[model samples]
Target: MYQAFYGLREMPFSLTPNTEFMVRLPGHQECLNLLLVALEQGEGFIKISGEVGTGKTLLCRALLNSLDAERFQLAYVPNPCLTPEGLRRAVARELRLVEADSLGEIALLEAINQKLIELAHAGRSCVLLIDEAQALPDDTLEALRLLTNLETERSKLLQVVLFGQPELDDVLGQERFRQLRQRITFSYRLKQLEGEQIERYLNHRLSVAGYNGPALFERAALRLLAQGTRGVPRLINIVAHKALMVGFGKGQRRIPRSFVQRALDDTEGVQGPANAQPRWPWGVAAGLVVALTLWQAPALLNWLQPWLPTVANAEQGGGDESGQ
Candidate 1:
């Protein structure tokens, strides 16, 4: 609603994992580089775990966009809350295997394997990118491990990349998943953006959305925003969007600290104690001043009593001279 008012061509803070607005902050860039390197090395299994709203989905999309279609055939399973059979079918659908729905489990596995072998022979690598992999049932996860077994004598026919929340790590840590966990040739844990990165992230997104005006967010406002959102990109975007709206409502072009606070207050799951450090040192200094004043009060009063008469006489002389 406030795009034109702010001189922005589009909404920059939308929650969608739009690769166009993808910011390669330190953590994300490292993860992306790791994925690319792992893929180049023909790693059989790769795992990336991040907290919710840490941009795992964005990273997944970015990875897909980065790979070459001619060299890499992508199978993306965005939702993995399915049974083993359903998971197999989803992979088949993504791979465009024929009659995947009509085949039984055994037949489906054979068909998927055949397709992978064909792709391998054609000098194309097939990568299965599974998002939200934390929701995959244990049996289904095991089934996926088995799927990676489809390989030729030289290299694996299929490579798997799992993108999920931290719960996925908990799931994989179990003894039952030991074999599968061992197969993870590359693993990366995505972290929230650091304090310095938040401003760059905001500006990058704004620029991508065609914003070219002066600084819309004040430095104090940006600092408060970083604290409020804990430097999570998604939360930052949410708070920033609402802050812009709040600024628009007030007909203000520049977003002040108060508007960002209002945005943080209005946002659910983000309305917590301020993440900024407490001013305990100031409190301690104040306490020391009070204690010193109280300790010296008696001596201070005694010292003032001797000077009181002289000060009164001088004041009287000055008054007498004025009277004359």
Candidate 2:
């Protein structure tokens, strides 16, 4: 709603995993590098674990985008809540096996194996990326193991990368999954953005979204964002988006730290304490601003028409009025 007011070309804090908005923070960059190295080395299995909203899916998509189309035949399974039979068919279908739908389990496996071999012969590496893999059934995981059994003397025919929450580690630690666990040639744990890094992350995304004005967030606002959001990208996006709306509603160009505090207070499941005082009053103040704007909008617009572009844009019916 505040895109025009802020001069943003697009929403900067969207939860969607757009590679365009991706920031190469240290943890994510290191994880990307390790995945590249592991794949180049033809590692059969790789695992990446992170907390919820720590950008696991984004990283998975980023890795998918980074691989060369000519050298990589990619099979991405976003949901792994399939049975053993279901998984084999999924892999087969990803390999473009027309027989997958009609074939029985054994034939499906053979078709997948043959397809992997063909890709290898044509000098293409097959990569299967499984997202939300912590939900994978026990039997289906064994199916994945058996699929990895297909290999030439040089390297495994298909490389598998698992992106999942930290629960994935506990699942892998089970004695029943020991054999499969041993096959993971590479693994990395993704950490949340550090408090100091939140500033850079926010600015980086804003710049990407075509924000070229002076720094939009004040230091206090940045500090509040860093503390209240706990450095989780998802949480940061939510709070920052709301804070921007708060600023817009108050007709402020720079985000007030009070606004971020209000955003955090309004957010559920966020862990930060109410470190910033006077929260209720600021919320009331923002409400009063909105209320006052509606009450005296015409006179306010007439008075500020020459000084404020925001009011001028509103007069032109150009200001964003969409809901939060």
The global C-alpha lDDT for each of the candidates, from Candidate 1 onward, is: 0.87, 0.87
How many backbone clashes are present in model 1?
0
The candidate scoring highest on TM-score is 2
> What are the TM-scores, per candidate, against the unseen true structure?
0.83, 0.86
User: 1-324, model 1: which lDDT tens digit per residue?
Assistant: 678878888999999999999998888999999999999889999999999899999999999999999999999999898898998999999899879999998999999999998999899999999999999999999989989999999999889999999999999999999999899989999998887799899999999999998888999999899888888888999888878876766667898887787777666566357523333433213333454457688887797898999999999999999999
lDDT, candidate 2, 1-324, per-residue tens = 678888889999999999998899999999999999999889999999999999999999999999998999999999899998998888888889988999977778888888999999999999999999999998899889988999999989999999999898998899998999999989999988886689899999999988998888889988878877778999999888878878877878788788788888777657747543445645634743794689799999888778797657776674355531
In Å, residue 32's CA in model 2 sits off its true spot by 0.4
RMSD of each: 15.7, 9.3
Predicted structure 2: lDDT: 0.87
